[model samples]
Target: MTSPILRDPGNSGFVVELEKFSGPLDLLLHLIKEDEVDITDLPIAKIAVQFLSVINELGLNQAADYLEMAARLLRIKAQMLLPRRLGDDEWEDPRAELVRRLLEYQQIRELVEWLGHAADARAERFGRGYEAPPPDAPPAPLQIDLNDLLAAAERVIALMPDPNLHHRVVPRPLDVEGATARILALLAERETFGWRDAVGGGPQATLVDVLSTFIALLELAKRSVLTLSQPEPFGPMVITRGISREAA
Candidate 1:
């Protein structure tokens, strides 16, 4: 029978004509069945030669698995040729391992075939097809009364944690007016200084204080009370007395 042509993945241009056998074992099994010989008593010499010939005909680019199987067959053939020692009747057959593998593969293949047929037979048998409800059909009536629903709602509400427990009231640290007085006091002490010096406390400064100081700085900049400058991007903002402050 003509084999199927498979495109080689390594070389897109190369095409491989693969036989019906799925793998090296499948090919070996096919050869054994064709010869009509018992698996336990495998003709190692003839089988090895046939296996090698088939591999060569397939070409040098055959899979590594096939090459390995070829090598195994050759080794078995060599083992079979070794002469038996006199009075050594307890000699183990080299073909024993290969025979076991073939037998197992054959059983699995048969089981798979049986399963395929069973699946086909199952598909032929049918069940009552699904019948969708009519679109105009009225929805089912509620099983619970209004009193039962209210009781369930009350139970759910009781399980919820009290909102008042999470509520927090923090006093404001400083307002914009307080921030402006602090900046003015710092300016009076020094003609020019960084905004951090005006804000005070560095990293220890609270978020409320920082926000209030920033708002005060923007208001001062707007009124021209102080000029804000950063020599480099993201550098510390330099505060210099504006004309309004110098005039004062």
Candidate 2:
């Protein structure tokens, strides 16, 4: 059976061909933009229905990611629909979690785009080509893959100690340049630095700080300025300076 995804094409019933995506988050970004909805302020119920409807074309095997996202949306919608008692000022907004995930995914998408563009630019320019002498011994195998570096970052972040941040509005977002410099500085002072130490802390060190610092480390690792290593399974990741100036 064929399925048609509602594109919100001026009518809820108007169907459009389902386009392929890398994952459910990619599809969610498309829907959010198509519906002219704000990421920070999602229309949870409406988007929830729309998302589920759109994924009907994907079949169960290909639809797991979308299904998971849809569940989150419905759960958020359900909590929002439940009547709040009068003077219930302490309840947290259920939408916050979804919004945070959306923002984080968007950031990763942008970073990947930039890396792609940089790759293309490097390909276009001519470089000084010279013949190198034969290696004295067999060449060394590549120590790390950039994707694995990112995974290492993921592991570190997943294992991070929750600062149990107090609820407050962030006045300004974390600075990437500042965070990058701090991490580099920490590495310079010592041969290696802990993930938490590289991330730093204070009233200003929000989760955003940790995320930004991670991305900064990713960029550094991309430039071969830093490396990440784990001595044992689930041990603390060590961030150290890389001797080689090469991209993996």
Candidate 3:
């Protein structure tokens, strides 16, 4: 589905069907395009007015995420309204910070656009049956033994020894209690969501969360709470909750 947040307001002069605004940067970009103004010397009053108009239209729920930026714009507008102090040769422009932030946003926006372009190119290639270029491999193998691998593994384990030597641990703190709850909630709503989506953009969890979630998910798999399948190695595992029973 297309993100409403990225849609352009119509070309009609008044009473635009405002798409959902994601954040302050989105609002600022909208105002910039609307006014056709340079970022450096943006008319604070005009931009602020446009911003307020959009906010009023957005109402409370949609506006909550954007309040910080709206407040910032107001602060800048306030500074612009105030008279400069006496004997100040170089006055700091109220628009400077806003300009800086907008520039950064623009850079990121360009990056996203570039990535989208690349993705489209990749899609085209796939559509045309493009095979990936072969990976370069070592000219010769540097052979090592099973004992050497085991000894290296032991050394690493010794470096960061777990204090509790003998404990059949119930579960780690980063256990998936909350994540599992969230997963269940999502499944209840969506029926089936991508396993990758279940993880969200992750903040991802720490190693503990990843490990415990994997273990917990494995347990859930055993209990037939969910089904996990890897149709393709190195691809995302497909998960459909409340199906199939197999040891994780």
Candidate 4:
């Protein structure tokens, strides 16, 4: 049996300079947009028709990435077309899986768009015409306190039991402007949130982001620009500001 592939390159407008089509799912998303099919209620029959038509146009030498999704789509279409027996509890629509996959892709796309906007804003802010003020009239550097560093260091050190374990503990780099802003924003809206609650649960990236946020807050407190209070010194700290900088 011939392997499925999306062959036609006609107006697949995903021709924009992406590094490469990552996989079949990537190709499916492109085809959906190219064919102007709704993501939620994907017309499997119509999509499958357009999909195979494109494959026929491409002939051989088609990229495996597009081929994979094409195969998956064909399978889904087959399953959807299969007649259901009476009183079958396992009868489920194949389009449901495709919709879920599309929803996830949409989420990633939205995040990518947001990041692009942020990058553009940063570029404009730091562009060629950006000149620093004279040294005498320079903006004051943010204040940093010694005690705050000690406290943060102490918290980190406590994670390790043996003094020898200190070397095993990597010193995390101190740069969390975004995370710091998020924490401050959350605190501003709601007076208190447990440190863990603010951090949330996820992969290592999220954990490290939260750790960086705590460090940022401590750094701010050292400058006397913010204050932290723990009703119980060992308990969760309640973060508040000394300076009137916009929350977050």
Candidate 5:
């Protein structure tokens, strides 16, 4: 699909081309796909910042729907920052509702695209006849709305197999302790490593493993066992042995 071009408000001569999105939800989905992160496990803080950047760049602040979605992202980001209370093992994720909406929107968008393609193909196969309808023919009744499409999407999704079922069969909790030990072992072999290295096994590593390793890195940094640095926002994190590790 061709991207749309927008004139820069700051500079009269500057023009920017951005991917066309149907709405705020479509924009969010595009950003998520660019990051290549799972919809179920979103990095809310990062995604929120990216979302705001896109809105500001396009001068969409005046658009009420876009502004509303921006506010929603900020709220979710703030909720995720709050520390969990002790003994509260069932803390619901702040991103849950947003994720659900995004999933539903995605399914409906796909269905619509499929339907459009089918209609085009049918049109090609059957030539349009020049017969006019009766003068008193009734207009076609409205058959579908947002609610109907959402319900149909839900039914389709319910019939599909769960993607995470295999993980449920052999559930392994996030192994922070093991992750820490592995990081230490890696440091023993080298002076520095990147986030992917700490996580290990490259693409084979599961999301749970990546998250647990990240937590382990934070713990190590807190104890002065390692130093973590990122050159810029949304950049790769680098790990190096700390002064304490050197002394030890």
Candidate 6:
């Protein structure tokens, strides 16, 4: 199925295969392997950059498809840069989604290739044309066994999340007094904290950080130490001095 697609037209003897790829997911795997890059320690940013040139060669027909996968690579890179730590249970392997898609696509491609080979062999055999069915042939009605159906149901249910196996821990709440002190220290250097900065984490912020920072802001508000405002709805939340710029 290898088609010898040019990996690098700039250099001679640099090629891969079009038949090996159904879309960008398969192509991404080929790209990563072409450079002899480590899958364990993925060079996401570098791979994303190189993927753009490869997609360009593929042309507008697959423009939408390639762009989607490229976005995933960039997002994974961004996720790695920010938020040094995530909750142990909450954190998911960033590469898992892409890898899953690649595996599924590869399986489908292999199956299709096998089916095509079988069809070619059948075409070469004689008496391949369809013949009339025998008269009075009893059509067998498709019957489903209850046990077989139950087995399939169990298989599907197994995929569902099991709460019994998990251990969930609730983070202890922070003291308002302590939160206030931390906020004051954060304000010592800078006059304002950006929306994300004030929250301490991005959208999926830890419950502890969010609640503590919020209580801290409330304590500051009570003392007229700081102000919170947003230009419009859904805009960035800013924290500024309410009255006097006092640390206390």
Among the numbered candidates, top lDDT falls to: 5
Instruction: Give a tens-digit lDDT track for model 5, residues 1-248.
Output: 21111323463432233358778899999999999999999999888888887876776655778778988998998999899998898999889999999999999999999999999998788566858766987877756677767776875566455696754432777889999999999989888988879999775676678788999999999998889998644446899988775567
Write candidate 3's Cα lDDT for 56-120 as tens digits: 55552144446567677778888888898888988988788879989998888899989999998
lDDT of 6 by residue, 1-248 (tens): 22123233343332343564667867877887799887666777778777766665655224456667767787887886776465668877787776677667767878989999999998888785777886896877646577767775874565455578585465565655666676687788688886567665464555566677888887787878888887643445788866774544
Q: Report residue 206 deviation for candidate 5 (angstroms).
A: 99
lDDT per model vs. reference? 0.77, 0.76, 0.68, 0.66, 0.81, 0.68
- Candidate 3 scores a C-alpha RMSD against the true structure in Å of 23.0
Single out the weakest 10-residue window by summed lDDT for candidate 3: 3-12
Candidate 4 per-residue lDDT, tens place, 133-215, comes to 75786676645477766786886675545665444434565447866777667767765565654554432334456677788
C-alpha displacement of 54 in model 4, angstroms? 3.3
Q: What is the TM-score of each candidate against the true structure?
A: 0.44, 0.43, 0.41, 0.39, 0.45, 0.38
Q: How well does candidate 1 score on lDDT at residue 140? A: 69
For residues 1-248, what per-residue lDDT tens digits would candidate 1 score against the true structure? Answer: 22212323344333244656678888889898999988889988788777776655565236677778888987888888899997888998889999999999999899989999999999999889868876896876656677767776885576455687684344875588988999998888887999678787775565677788899998998999888887643346888877775567
Model 2 has an lDDT value of 0.76
Task: List where candidate 3 sits over 4 angstroms from the true fold.
Answer: 1-20, 60-62, 85-87, 127-248
Q: What does the lDDT come to for candidate 6?
A: 0.68
lDDT of 3: 0.68
Per-residue lDDT of model 2, residues 208-244, tens digit only = 8878888898899888888988775445678987876
Clashing pairs in 4: 7-55, 143-223, 144-222, 144-223, 145-222
Best by TM-score: 5
lDDT of 4: 0.66
Question: Which window of ten consecutive residues has the lowest lDDT sum in model 5?
Answer: 1-10
